[model samples]
Target: MSQTLISPGISVANDDKQRLGPRTRFGLLASITVTFLAGSSVPTPLYPIYQDQWHFTAMGISFIFSIYAISVLAGLLVFGRLSDYVGRRSVLLWTTVLQLVAMYMLGVADGFTDLVLGRLIQGVSTGAAVPAVGAALIDLNHKRGAVVNALTPAIGSAVGALMGSVFAQALPYPTHTVFAALAFILVIQGVGLLLMRDIRAKIPGAARSLIPQFSIPVDVRGPMIIASSLFVAGWAVAGFFASMGPRLIEQLFALPASWAGGLVLAAFAGSGVAAIGAFVTRSMHTLAWIGALGLLIGMAMVLVSLITGSLTPFVFGVVISGAGFGAGFQGGIRLVLSKSRAEEVAGVLSVAFLCCYLGMGVPAMIAGYAVASGHGIFDTAIVFAILVMSLSFIAVYRMISGGSRV
Candidate 1:
């Protein structure tokens, strides 16, 4: 049971005979990361279907969506650092099992209550698994790990939204089919985990780690704040698209197809993935500025589309803002992790993602209430775009004034 210390609080169990190779482990971990996120977003396209079937209001949909975020926050607070003491593989494996249960619940869901409960379970599983898998990736390769962490959400969301849409449109049982597929994938991922190595050593304080806390190092605090702001701005837009984009598209643009919502979400997420490659060589500060400007310009276009009642501009605006979302999020993550010690990886990521989920959940929930309370989608979206634009302006100013020090 010999172990090698990789950092202050992290260690590798040297059991080459029993564990998979590092490269193999990295690939598996990355796949698992993508799978978990994909599972979370798979429900986006199905929201419209659920609404149609159950006759729920916009506020009901928002509750279902936001409840997932709330549960994720609970999971992150309680279990974010558990892997830092127990082991990454164990945490991931158990969470995968929980996700499978969630998929089952969602797959067989008959109404709103079932959907809400399923999402809550799914969110908790995703929340607990995120920090574990994120830390594991970093444990393997710091630079690549950060890139994967930054890029995977977009990639997984894009894939999930598209898949769910296609399946919902073409398949017999819309909800059942997608969740079954996700559950199958999770089963494979769990098996893969059993074959892989646990890179981190089990440490003491496993019980104390259950208490909710953030462990950000002093050096990482400044970048974390900047990153948290970017996360809040970017994910709020994503949340809106996920929860309300389909309805907005149907109402304003006259596109009633099931795939339209998924396409809009996919475009936003896909553009983000593309932004990472286009701006990979840029400095962190420059990337942040570019992202902010992109958000501002893109949101302005969205406002125009709303006013003019044109779909073309809306599509174009989504692409641009989505690019900004991707680039800005990457810059924020790179800045935060660039200064973080290895020991701070899990805690830093936990706080970062907590903010990310908060941003994603809160604004969308508010918009749902507004829409349900008499504000039209167009009006609510206009206000939402304005708020995002304001945030983007602040982000740009922060980067310019702070310079490389940020």
Candidate 2:
């Protein structure tokens, strides 16, 4: 089954035209994956600067952030399966172009409207590209691809947040420099993608594929349900940090350094990357259990830090929670995809990511509104931590009680 998926419908003549070896193709695709996600997070550390310059309300900031998630969801629904129908390379190329355009818009953004529009475009590009590239990775090497898919989000996000912070603090134009740099990288990646091959054959029903759909194969549904909590718990924590971490840093720790929020986010995401690498060899169930426990303990420490207004413990909590986030998310991906077929890759991955973005976008939006509605950042953080901790507890119970058994 895996062999067929990797070499579907390629004749001798087509193979002769292939420009890069499988290893090279995989490397390019992996880099593209990392870059796409990095672009999405590049703006996270810049949000505080935007607020300071434009004086946008917390609700307004939330709207800006949530708009990206909403657009990504729309893109996912509309284009998720298009790659399976048309081809992975085609979808990826077009989306990379869209991402380039988004970076330009964001670089020049002078106001809230511009920021919102740029984020919308960025979101759509991500939506369309995620499943295509994801499917392509699996096609190239299922085992490595799955691991790369699991690791890229954390790695990309960590790099983006940290880079943005560093550039913002050190460069002349904080906002413009990062976007421009990212745009340049995208340009290079787009050219590289042209040299790559689309291993998946173009199936019939291309037009119908444009219609929005979400599905998990019958065999995958049970694992999907079991992994859903892990998705929510992990990403909800991420969403909180991305959208509100900077503000939390300012309000709670009385630190006004631009790099502080980005540092915290980098630590959180970087730790997750480390955790995924550390536990990549573990069984899916074991990874899930570890992730759940990490989330529970980490969130508890975070809550304590918030209550005591201790920055050190808060940082420690962030790192621990980040590890859980990575491990749990990776475990969830492995669990759901464990039973999926090659043809089902795009749809399954799309649904899986849909759950992820929902977890990432919704709670942050709610927190934004809550803060705007007179709940202080600390108060909101406490409430958010408690909620995530509760979810983590549920995930732990589910994993331990054999509820996730397929």
Candidate 3:
């Protein structure tokens, strides 16, 4: 009903509600951020079903999936620094609005094209919102960097995947139901965000902020590259999981209607959440080791499972590697944040995310094309692991060799 944008720097909370302390506010904001990210991957478990019903090939499926990464890349390249010039609340609120529109599109999707459109919009909304939301968490809690960002998205992805898969299996409408429920939840989150007070000071000239800058100041490049490396490795692995995982499960385990795919994804994200929580107060250096080791072990397990056609080893691999993914992501971000100025926080992180999603999207598209070209899934997956595994080693080497700041 209210169309007002709630101009920047103004408190939206009522006088009585303003009495709540900063910690409570942080928790609320963090929860909202998680909800925002959770919807990003809800469609993961449903991919196999789409393939069957829509008769889309592996490349088609990969194309639909990869579009999200591309759209997000575009958003980041353009609007990534927007939150730096605008207030965090304004950026975050706009993300919710965009998310709501994406969810509605997803809920009403009829064919493969609709799925493509839905994911495309979803990517843009998610990309624009994440930097701001991540910045807000760090802004609220100075000590929070990787742990908060890692834990929130991990929790969100896990819960969203698990819930979407469960509803698809149990509900009457399946896809429609999940999207509808998500839209409803986002509506609630949107209201909460609208009512929340702005925490950051608003800069003037936000209206004229249209240069499309991807600023990587000289001082921040080393940490940014290091972060980008880890992000590529982490998200490349995710590319395998999100794009090919269900089909992998179906072919190997013989469960074509695969909730196992979602479970594996959940395990990956949940383990990451757990690891970050356990080491919340620890240094990024420690998390880097944990991430590297976990990734190596996890990738090995995944290979073994694929080779043997066993589900147990695959589950073990996904869980362990997911911890690595979470750690690498957080460690990299935290490492960068340690070097970042307040004004440059969102922009720097946006570049980091751009690298990460490129890793997530591009490799998976290749894999999809690989499958479409009649390559054995196991062989293609092995190649993917080899590339990502090399990065893991590099991360470890850098972490230990005192070149970690790279």
Candidate 4:
């Protein structure tokens, strides 16, 4: 009964034979991941407030969002590779501290630069957290089922998005409260991380380093490319829903920010159910293509909503698009996890998330800039939806083609 945390690469394949209780570990890992990811969306419902108070345009909002995603990417590129070298709990503890810094900066910021800087820190925290948390889930897994690891992250992400919106709309301190609550959660996580039975520092060096680890090995390229494409498309749908959906609701449907928050919740709720269904039935890949089609239809729905100016269609579109996003994202994770060894799991998942956050960040920035330059929000939203649809279809085609070849 060794209590040391298992390092992915150390080849202790037989030396570490301890069995972590499935239910307890799953619960702990799920809570940690949900908390880590929830911080990303804490600012979603408040962007409009920033816009009004700061007199910043939509592009400014996109820049703000991009800072978070970019930091996440940087974390993935650098810290993700290290998770394979270090133990998972150590990375999670560091991530919690980084997240606290991000929340504190946002809470105390007095100007636009402060907001951007806070988001940048937030992105780094999220980047650090994802690989560590995702790897931890896989490490604890003893079940024959791989979907648990994949679905756990998706479920956690959706719950994070949902909770952030609910609290932002319902809580008293609109600007400061969410960050404060998140900071409190991080403190709890940091403590919990310390208490966890397995906290081994696998990588022995003079100092912990932060350097980007790139260069795909020849053998990993095919699956990695597939995983990358799947995430890019799946996350593009998420980006549109996050960045454009709010503006569309405010302008077209005349809904309050709270109502828009509800829409965001509905999207995540629907997607969460779909992901659970995938987990139960083991339909991750099968349902993924269907979700792609759902994305296509959802994109068309957005276009129609713009043309007809119907709130119902737009709301329905969000839910539909969300289902597609969840299925594809989770499914892609399943495909990669199925092929990877336990040691490589975190590195691959980190790459997938890097693609996902990038998809979510970059395109939204483009659309946000267009909106800032006097293009109608409706026009920007529609165009963004169309691009997502196209990219998703291409990914779907690749999945289908690869399946047929196999």
Best by lDDT: 1
lDDT tens digits, residue span 1-406, model 3 = 1222222323233334444466766776777667766676778888877777888898897898899889888878777777767778788788778888888888888899888898888888788888887777776665664467767877887887787679768777777888888888888767776767666656676755546676787877777666676788888887778778888777788874448777777778888888787777777777777788888889988888877888888888888899888887788878887777766777787888898889989999999999999998778888888788888888777666655445
lDDT of 1 by residue, 62-117 (tens): 89989998899999999998998988989999999999999999999999999989
TM-score rank, highest first?
1, 2, 3, 4
- The alpha-carbon RMSD values of the candidates against the true structure, listed in the order shown, are 1.4, 2.3, 4.1, 3.3
Worst 10 residues of 3 by lDDT: 1-10
Candidates in order, TM-scores: namely 0.97, 0.96, 0.91, 0.88
**Candidate 1 — what's its lDDT?**
0.87
Highest TM-score: which candidate?
A: 1
Candidate 2: tens digits of C-alpha lDDT, residues 60-124: 88899899988988989999999888889999999999999999999999999999999999999
Per-residue lDDT of candidate 4, residues 256-359 (tens digit): 76447535644654564575465446554675665577677776786788889987787777767767666666667676666677766767777778788889
Query: How does model 3 score by TM-score?
Result: 0.91
For each candidate, the alpha-carbon lDDT, in order, equals 0.87, 0.87, 0.78, 0.68
**Model 1 off-target regions past 4 Å?**
5-9
Model 3 alpha-carbon miss at residue 335, Å: 0.4
lDDT of 2: 0.87
Candidate 1: C-alpha RMSD after superposition? 1.4
CA shift of 385, model 1, Å = 0.5
